[model samples]
Target: MDRVWEAELRLPTPLVELRDPLFGTCRVLLKRDDLIHPDVPGNKWRKLKYLVRDARDRGADTLLTFGGARSNHVRAVAALGERLGFRTVGVIRGEERPTNPGLRRAQERGMTLHYLDRATYRRKSDPDVLAALHDRFGGAYVVPEGGTTPLAFPGLAELVNEFDRPYDAVVCAVGTGGTLAGIAAALPAGRRAIGISVLRGAWSLDAEVAALHRSVLGHPLDNWTIDHRFHCGGFARRDARLDTFLARFGDRHGWAPDPVYVGKALLGLSVLTGAGEFDGETVVAIVSGPGAG
Candidate 1:
């Protein structure tokens, strides 16, 4: 598996300058983690690398995880399973959609799809719900929604270490808060990380990132903060402002970022820059890639 990872995955993903008028005085660079792989791109690769290893170490032959129908995490897990020869099961939230591209890709990659109602999915962490899954799957190793776990931090830390230049701050779109927590935990002494939340009204994201830090690093660090004002609407929801920004961004940059995560983060950064928040600072925005489909 290690050999496969080393041979197949792109390490030290390219860092390139992002010249945008919206950034004003900020020197913005894009950490192109999105280019890490055709499948399992960006933070998905970072978060899952170790969890899969841990599953193997624990003698588990199957990987079980939770995600929405269009979840990038689900597609990444299925891709990893295909690459590494592990049985994969994706417990999807809401009704199954046979035509959903992401779910269909996972199915093609040999992932068993299981659908759960929204209410039951909310209780996925409950022991009873987990036990029921275990009974059906027979002792599969379970990865949480968005693949955020203590085991995931180590791989995420490597992302920070791969930076080839100095910067005042690093930024990424916050979904489960794992990517931000992991990056912030590994940042150098003076640098900081800012997370742009993609979930509307996600006031608890700061607390969640802090708890993740405490879980893995033994204490929470103060080098990180989250911005909840730019969700556009909610997860997978996009409004006219975001759509306009994405269109302009794609026209200028020659790449179209998915509205769900990367687009939202860049839009937030642009707003922050316009407000003089990142004036005269160097910011590296992580292009975590478009989620499945």
Candidate 2:
């Protein structure tokens, strides 16, 4: 397989200072992973790096992954497949909408999109469902939803290794918990990583992240934590308070984070900082990317 696509990615993405009253007394820096690639950005790129290599090593010409209609993971997979000369299949949850921008972009990148009803999507990992998909797609390499498998950890770990300055903590929004798991696994003693969950009522995210840690390193590390209070209703749902914050953020910073992930993360950081959690510490916030759709 050609390795040309690797050269196009911006590794060790720039870290820039973020000044705002929301962060209270803490000095914050933004890790601009969003600039890594136009199509495959941030943790999406990180998660896919090794999975693509694994697919190639197995002599697979097709990569099939699961996600919702607007998933960044699906879009990234499609873009990666186009760049690397592999066939891509996106097994999407819910009804198909041909007009959806993300899915349309994926299709333009030569991905075959297949939709599964919500109930069937819930069983996406079941043996029977997977077997049927394999039969339909003809031996494609499978990547799970959000690309959270063990193969993804190494790539995410590299993100932490690329930090150029000292920091007391690193923070990011959690969708699948893979990014948190990877960062937590790589952090040296004393420093910590915090995740702001984007899914409401996702109380089990901590366990899920720990399980991911165990999958990658044989044990769960303790230098990380997740804050579930800042999801702003739930995944893909935002209320007036969040909207107002984002508007103010945009006016001050010249860019507004997407409501689904990064915005929620910054909000959590704001609340946490105000509550004296990071009173005098320097923090780095991972700017993952704008939402997929």
Candidate 3:
């Protein structure tokens, strides 16, 4: 929400070395996007810049958005709204259980939390459902779940500036496809954007991202593909292997991965590079985890 964003708003995210599994032959690097900001860090910050601008430009005083109970998007929107002078509302999916840290932070940031059952949450964008929210909130601007709207790309595309040169390929964990879409939107020539699905199910991520790209750029972009190998058995579903990998990764690299997004993408990077997937000298994984991890 700073006036500086009115310009190009190019960020300088750190790119750190993750591992040299092939004795420095096949090197893997981590794009430390999580360090981009404190309250609204990583991909969350990248996805919201233009969205916040759009809300303000429309003369909207209240910003309404959707996410899960523990969604980073919800917390980021709440924090940004509070700091930027916009009233925020969060449409949380699933029933509210006991105290959740993310939701608590959103509440502390003054976001009005509305809990919806799974069924209703799935239909959040339906006309009837949206109409209900409009009637109740009196015309607050709605940011889709995961902030994956057309407005998200401009901010996300700016993230491309963080990389001076393209690696063999750039990878990001996909939630609602906004992060991936933005990366693919500004994909430099000769570089590929790899979308690693962090959530399971039959939802066609390619189809969704294609639709989003078309809406924003007038056509779908090439040089991007989806990798379904890294969900770790669906969103938020952790097991012994994932836990062990996360622990070992943090212990070795000294950077703890957010169990939700960056951890899964890191696991995928290990798999792809170990199998000798790409022919480039360097591969980059956009790590939205804390600091170096």
* Candidate maximizing lDDT: 1
For all candidates in order, the CA lDDT equals: 0.91, 0.90, 0.79
Tens-digit per-residue lDDT, 1-293, candidate 3? 56643232225778877664532355677788887767778887888888888999999999999876767788889988988899999988877543487788889999998877889888998999999999988899998887888887787777777776547778788877888888888887888888878888636888999998888889989878888877878888776767888888777768668877888777777777667676446777897644211
TM-score for all models, in order of appearance: 0.97, 0.97, 0.91
**Alpha-carbon runs more than 4 Å astray in model 1:** 96-99
- Model 2: per-residue Cα lDDT over 1-293, one tens digit each: 35587788888899999989888899999999999998999998888888899999999999999998889999999999999989999998986544588889999999999999899999999999999999999999999999988988888889988888989999999998988888888887899999999999898889999888877788888899999899889899998889988999999999998889999999889889989999989899999987857
Single out the weakest 10-residue window by summed lDDT for candidate 1: 94-103
Task: Compute the lDDT for candidate 3.
Answer: 0.79
RMSD of each: 1.2, 1.2, 3.0
Q: How far off is residue 4 in model 1, in Å?
A: 3.3
How far residue 109's Cα lies from its native spot in candidate 1, in Å, is: 0.9
Better model by TM-score: candidate 2 vs candidate 3: 2
For candidate 1, write residues 146-213 as lDDT tens digits. 99999888998899998988899998999989999999988999999999999999988889998988
| Reference-based TM-score, model 2 | 0.97
Q: How many backbone clashes does candidate 1 have?
A: 0
Better of 1 and 3 by lDDT: 1
User: Residue 245 deviation, candidate 2, in Å?
Assistant: 1.1
Alpha carbon deviation, residue 137, candidate 1 (Å): 0.5
User: What RMSD value applies to candidate 3?
Assistant: 3.0
